[model samples]
Target: MDPLDSSISLGAASEAAAAKEDVESPDALLPWARFSAWLECVCVVTFDLELGQAIELVYPLDAKLTEKEKTSICYLAFPDSYSGCLGDTQFSFRLRHSVGRGNRGTWYEDGDLYNRDAPVPLQKEQSHLYGYVYFRQVKDGSVKRGYFQKSLVLVSRLPFPQLFRALLQVVAPEYFEKQEPCLEAVCNEIDQWPAPAPGQVLTLPVMGVVIQVRIPSSDDKPGDSPVTPSPKENLLPAPIILPSPHEQDLFQCFQSMLIHVQMLWELMLLGEPIVVMAPSPTMCSETVLALVSSISPLKYCCDFRPYFTIHDSEFKEYTTRTQAPPNVILGVTNPFFIKTFQFWPHIIRLGDVKMAGDLPKQVKVKKLAKLKSLDTKPGIYTAYKTFLHKDKMLIKRLLKGIQKKRPCEVQSALLRRHLLELTQSFIIPLERYLASLMPLQRSISPWKTPPQIRPFSQEEFISTLEHAGPQLTSVLKGDWLGLYRRFFRSHNFDGWYRLRLREMTHKVESLHLEVTCDADLLAWTIEKSEVEIVDLILKLREKLLRARKQQLGVGEQLLERLERSIHTVINSLPNDLQALLHRH
Candidate 1:
C-alpha cells in the first residue's frame, strides 16, 4: 500500500476504535477522561560557567528524553542573553521528537505514550510538544558566580502560556525554597486539574492560584462577547482569566506597525514565510503567538516556532537558501538572524516597549540595506503585495483611541475583534460553497454504493463570491474577489479543504450507518424472491466487509445485529431455500 494510504488506514482504525469505546462508555467522550494531565514534566535549567546552560533537574526523574532533546530544552529555557539581568522571564518553544519510537527516548506523562504521528500530514512523522518556561535570576552568595539563574520549565501539549506561567509563579519560588518535593506536590496538583477542553470555561486551581480560561473553538462567532469587559467586572476576586489561549496583546506588540495591520493579517492567512526579530525572547515569542492567532477560530495550519535558536535541529534547514523558505513563522532575538533571513520575503523588526508619553516609532517599509544600516530602528522589510487594500477606517479608529488616551488593553481588544471578524467574513463564503458540495441524504440508496462528495471546482466556488463573499465591513476598498482567488492557491486553503473533507466524509458515513440500521430487513426479505433475498444478503455482507476494510467507526454491535437479522430472515424462508442459500 502507498505510505499515505497506510497512514490514513491506521488513523481511521484508531478513530473507529475510539468511537466504539466512546459508544460503549459515554464518559470516554468527556474532556477529563480523554487527556492524561495538564503538566507533562517540570524541568529545571541552570546556567553553568563552563558547560553553559544545562539541565539541573527534571522532576519525576524518570521522564525520558534524548541527549539532543535535553540540550535543546536547556538552551530554550534560558534566553540568549549576554547581560546578567536579574528578574523573571517567561517564554515558550516547540519540543519536537520522532513519532515511531515508543516512550523510551521521548517525554511521556503517566505511562501514556505519544500516539499522534503528526499534527499535519507530512512524509516524516514527528510530535510537536509545547514547552512553557519560567526563568528567574537572583543574586546568591552561596554560588561563586554571585547570581543563581535557573528556569523552571513546564512541558505539555497544552498551549496555555498564561495559565502555565501563573502555575510556575506559584511553584518555581517554592521549588527554590524546597527542591524536589515541591515539584512532586505541583505535579500531583496538576494531575488533579481537569483537561483543557475547547469551548468551555475551565476553572483550574494550581497551588494557590486559580486560573479561569476559555479555549477558543472553531465554531465561535465574532460577536459572541465584547472585546474587553469593564474593570469593575474583573475585580470580583476572579482567577487569572483569559478569553483565549493566545492572549498576547496585539495592539501593544504591533503598536508601531498598527497602520499595516491589514497587510500582516493578509500575510498570515496566505501562510507566507515571515520572521520576527525582537530584543527579548518574551517579546519575540509573544508576538509570534499573537500573529498566529490573528485569524482566530481558524487554526494556522503552517509550522511556527515562537522561540527559535541557532542550536535547534532545523537551524540549517531554515537558514539555508538552497530552496525557497518553507511556509513557517520563526521568532528570533539574535542579531545574527537579520543577515541569515535576509532572503526571506517578510521580516518584522520590533523595538523594546516604550514608557507612557514616549513617542511610538512608526514602522517604515525599508530595503535590506537600509534595515542593516539602521539596525536599531523598527521596520517591516517585505516585497509581497497585499491583495486587499488597507482598512484606513480601522486604523483611524485605533489612532483615535490612542489619541484619546484609551487603555492599551482596550485598543488591543478592538484590533483582535476586527481581525476575528475579517477572518470570519472571508471564511463564510467558502464554508457556504463547501456545504453545497455535500451529497444530500435523499440521494442515498440502499442497493447502490455510497455517494462521494462533489469535487471542488475553483471556478464554481469563485462564481458565487460576487453574492456570497465577505461583507462584514465597508471600510476597505479593493478586489475582494481577487484576494479570494489568490487565497485558493494558498497552503491555508489546502489545509482547510482537507479538514472539511474529512468531516463531511465522516458525516456521510454516519448517515449511511443510520439508514442501514433503520432498514426493515425481515419485511423486505419476506416480499422478495429467493434469488433476490440471496442478492440482498450478499450486498449487506459486502457493505460490512467494505466498512471493516475502510476502518470506519461502524459500530460492531450494529454489524452483529444486521448479521442476526439476515440470519433470522433466511431461517424464516423455506428449509430447502435456506439450504440452497447456505450452499450458495
Candidate 2:
C-alpha cells in the first residue's frame, strides 16, 4: 500500500461519516445521496495565455515596447512559471487541504523544519506555493509594482480551533440544516471581523445560527432540513462518467500539445529534429505521459508505471542493444545528459529558460556584472549560458518552419491519397530509425564486431499499417461501463475524471481520422493494386466505419450523462439559490 494512501484515501471520510449518520439519523436520507453533491461547492477555474499576455496582466508598462524587449523579457522570466493564463495574465492557483490527516493534520512542525544554515526551498515546502507575477522592465530595471498571491496554500495547517470551525462551515451536517441563514450569518460575521491580534478570540455567528436550527428527529427525511455530509464521505462521489467543464478545457489544451508532438515526430522522420522546452519537469512528464497514455492499450493495468529510463549506454557504443523504448524519449535539463546528447536529434529540455537571438546575449554583460558583485564566478558560467542561448536559437529556427500555415483544403479523396503516401513513404522507414537508435555505430569499429541492422521492407510497413486499423479500432472501442466502475473504485477527484474523458475523446478522434482516411486511401490505392489488397482494404473500411459509429454513439451517451449530473447539482440547491440562479 502507498504510505500516503491513508491520508489521501477517499474511503476514510465516507466510512466515518456513514457510521455517524447510521447512529444519529437513521431515517433521514439525502435527496441526492452522492459525493458530487458536496464537491459541486468547490470552484476550480483555469486560464491559458502567451508569455507577453502574462507579463501584461501583471506588469505596469510605461509604453508599448519594441518586439525585441518583449522577447528578452519572456526569456528572462521563463525559468519560474506555471501553465495557465487568465486572459493576458499567467497564474497558477490550487487550494489543497488534508483528507488523510482529517482536515487538521499539519504535515510539518512550525519551527522543527526551519533551519538558519540552510533555509527551506519554497518549492519543496508542501505548506504553501505562492509567487509574484511582475514584468521585467528592461535590463537592470527595478520592478515598478508587484503583489503576491497564494495558489497552493495549505488550509488544514491553520490553528486547530480555527481549522475545526472552517471545516464545520463546509462539511458539518448541522450547518446545512439552515444553509441560507448560515450563509447570511457567515457574511455578516465576516463583515464585522476585526484584524487579528495577540490572544484574539474570534467567533463566527454563522456557527451559532446553525446551532439554532432544530436537529431533525429520527422520523424526518432529508428534504425538511438539508444536512451537509463530510465531503470526504463516499469514495465514489458522482454518478457521472464524463469530465467537468474546467477539466474538459484542460484536456483540450493537452490534445493541442499532443498534435504539436505528432507534427514534430513527423518532421523528425524527415531528419529535422526539434527541441521542446517547458517550465518544469512535472510539465514535461505530464506531456510525455499524456501523449503516450492516449494511444497505449495498457492503460487499464493499474500496476503499470510507464516511464522512460535513459541509460548511460544510450550514448555509448559499448553494447549492441537499447534499454529504452524507440518511439519516445524523456529528457530533463541536466548538465551531464545535455552535454552528452547535445548533438542527438529531438532533444526536449524541461525547465529550459534559454531563448534564441542576440537580445539575451546583449543583456548577458549586465547580468555578468551583477553576478560578479554578488561574489559569484561570472567568468565560468557565462560561456555555459551562451551555449544554452545558441541551442535555444537552433530550436527557435526549427519551430519557425513548423509554425508555417499547413494545407487546409480538405477533400475526401485527396486526404486519403495523402495518408496512403505517408504510410508508403514514412512508415516504411520506421525500422531504420529504430535500428539507428540501437547502441551500434554505422561505421565499422576495429576492436569489436558490429551487429547487422535488421532489414525492414516496404512490404512490412504496408502490412503493419494495414493491421494498425483494427488495433486502433479495438483501442478506440473503450469500455465506458468498466471505466465508470474503475473511477468509482479509485475514489479519485473530478480532475481525474476530466482528464480520463479528455484522453478518451482524443483516442476516439485520432482513431476516427486514421480509419476514415485509410478507408479513403484504400479506395484510391485499389485501382492500381491486386485483388488481395483490394479485398483487405474493403474489409478494413467496413471495420473503420463501424468503429466510428460506435465511438460517436458512446460520446453522445457520455455527454448526456454529464449534462444530467450538472443539472442534478443545480436543481438540488436551496430555494434562495434557485431564485438567484433565475435572476442571473
Candidate 3:
C-alpha cells in the first residue's frame, strides 16, 4: 500500500485523458477528467471556523483544476433559491496531497489576495471571483470510480475595509489606518488608549464583534518591551474615550464585521481571553452568521465552542451542547456573568463604543459586588448567616408555597429537591466561613477573658453545640439527607461537629473559680438563657448518644464531655432536668 499510489490515482482509464489535457493546456486552468468525476459526488460541505464560523459550499462539475492538480479553480455557485449569499463566485484554491495510505489530505481556502489574508471580499448583487476552493480524495473506489471531498468559501463583497478600520480604531484609535497594523503595534496603541484603569471595563462596538474590555494594570504592557514606569506612576489609566467612525462607513459598519474575522483569530491566539459582547440576540446571531461564512481560506480551521446567552426563545437554537471551553465565548454582557466568573477577559471593541448603549448602564456594580468569605469559625457562622439572609425570602416563599399545595407525592418530591438544591448551593460558603474561624478559635487567650463574656472557649463551645444540634437533627430526619451525604462524607461532618463541641465542653468544665466577674457572667447569662442553652446541649448529647449506640463512630471522650455539658446545663436550667426535657 504505497501512500503516493493511493492519492495519485495511478493506472486509471481517465488518467491518460487528464495527462493529455495537462500537456495541451499548460496554462489553461482546466479540471482533470479524473478530478471532475470526483467533484460530481460533492453534494455540499460545511466547516465551523474558530472566530468567523461555519462555511457552506457546493461543488459543481464545471469546476477547473490547474495542470499540477495541486491547485484548482471553480465557479463557486450555490443552488438556485439557495440559502446564503447569492451570486456566481469564482474560487481559486490549493489542494494537499494525501498523507498516510488511508489518510485523506486536507486543504482550506486562501484569504483575499487584495485583502492581504483578511476576509474574502465578495461583491453584493454581482458575480465575482472571490473566496477559495478545497478538495480531498475519497477511498471508496467500489461504486463511483472517483470520489473527492470538496468545499468552497464564498462571501458577499460588502466593503469590509470600513469595518476592519473601525475595529482597528475601537481597539486603538490613534493608530487607526496609520498603515497595515500588526499585533505588536496594536498592543502599543492599546497601551496608550484613553481607557479606564485595569480591572475596569471598557466597551467597544465594531459591527458583529462587541467587546467588554477590562484594563488590568495601566503599567502592564502587552508587547515585549523593557518595563518603563509612567511619569505619573500614581495616576490611574485615562478614562475611556470611544472614537467615532467616519459617517460614510458607519451605516455599513455593522455588516463590515463579516470581513474582519482575521482580527478575532489573531486576538484569540494572543493568549488572553477575548470577551465578545453584543447589543441584542438578533445582532449577535446576525454577526456570528456573517462571520462564519465570510472568513477566508475557511478550511483547516480549529474547533470553537460558541456559548450564546440569548433570550429563552433562542437559547435552544444558539446555545452550545456543552460548557464552553475556557478559551471561546460569544454572547451579550450582563452582571450575572460578570459576577459568576472570577476572571475577566480583555475586551474586543467591535463597531463603536456607543453600540453597548444602556447595556452597560444596567450593570449594577454595587449590587452585584461580592466579597470572599472570611476565615474563622465565627466568620464561618457569619457567612452561613449571610448566605441564608440573602435567600431567606425565597426559602420562606418556597416553604409557604409547598404548604399551600395538595400533598401529591411527585409535587412533594420536587419541593424537597428544591430545598436540597437551595441548601447545597450555600454549603460551600458555610464551609469556607467555618474554615476561616479555626485560627481565631486557636488564637483565643487562655489567661484572659473578654470584658462581657464567660471564658472564650466556653462561649464558643456553647455556640458550636447550639448551631450543630439543629443541623445534625435536620440531617437525621430530612428525607434528602442522602443528597448532603453524597457531597460531604459523613465522617467529615461528624469530625468537624465533634471537635467544636468537645472544645466548648472542655472549657466550660475547666472554668476557674477566681470570683468569676459578675458583669461578665450577667452579660453571658442574658446572651444565652439557661433554659434554652440546656435544651440545646441536651439535644446535641442525645444525637451523639444515638450515634454511639448505632456504632456511627462517636469518639468516647467527645461523648463523655457532651454528657457532662448536658448535665451541667440541665442543672442550671429553670426547672429540673425531667420537667425541662419533657416540656421542650
Best lDDT goes to which candidate? 1
lDDT of 2: 0.28
lDDT at 484, model 1: 82
- Tens digits of per-residue lDDT for model 2, 1-584: 64224322323444455456646864324311222111112111111233222232211112222343333222322222333322222221112222222211122332222111111111123332112111111122232223221111111111122122233433223322342333333322322323221222222222322211111122323123223222223323322111110111213213223213333323222222222334442344344433323221112112111111122212253112344223223423223333443343444433322334421111121222222222222111111111001223323433343344222221212222322343233222333333333333324332123334433343453344443422232222223223223323331213333434443444444334343332233234434434443343345444445444434333444334433433343354556754554464
TM-score of each: 0.80, 0.23, 0.19
For residue 375, give model 1's deviation from the true position in Å.
Answer: 2.8
Model 2 clashing residue pairs (backbone) = 7-100, 14-233, 14-234, 47-85, 48-85, 53-88, 94-151
- The top-ranked prediction according to TM-score is 1
Candidate 1 per-residue lDDT, tens place, 1-584, comes to: 75334434444454566567768976566322332345556789988989989998876566656777788898888888732336888888876764442342333432222222212221122367678988888888998898888888887666667667777776777777677655655654554456555455677655555667665543445557723222235344556755555567888777888888888899999889999998888888988988988876666888888999988888998889889998999989888887888889889998775534644556878766655643557888887777778878888888888888889888988998889888887888888999999899998765566699999999998888767767644456677887887878788889889878987887787678657766778887666787888788877777777666554567878877777877887888889978876786
Model 3 over residues 1-584: C-alpha lDDT tens digits?
64223322322323454456568865323432222211221223322234211223223333332222211122221111111222222122112222221111111222212222222112111122122222222343543433322233221122222222334334322212231222223322222223222323444322123433332332333222223222233323432232211112211222223222223322322222333434332233333333322222121122221223322222343334355424333433332433233233333223222323222111111111232222111000001011112234433443344347533333333333433344333243334334434433433432244122232332343345434432542332232323333323333334344544454443332232111211132234346756656555554555554445433334566556555544554555566665856565
Error of 1 at 287 (Å): 0.4
Clashes of 1: 0
- The 10-residue segment of model 1 with minimum total lDDT is 115-124
Poorest lDDT segment (10 consecutive residues) of candidate 3: 376-385
Our model 2 lands, by Cα RMSD against the true structure, at 26.0
Q: Of models 2 and 3, which has the larger TM-score?
A: 2
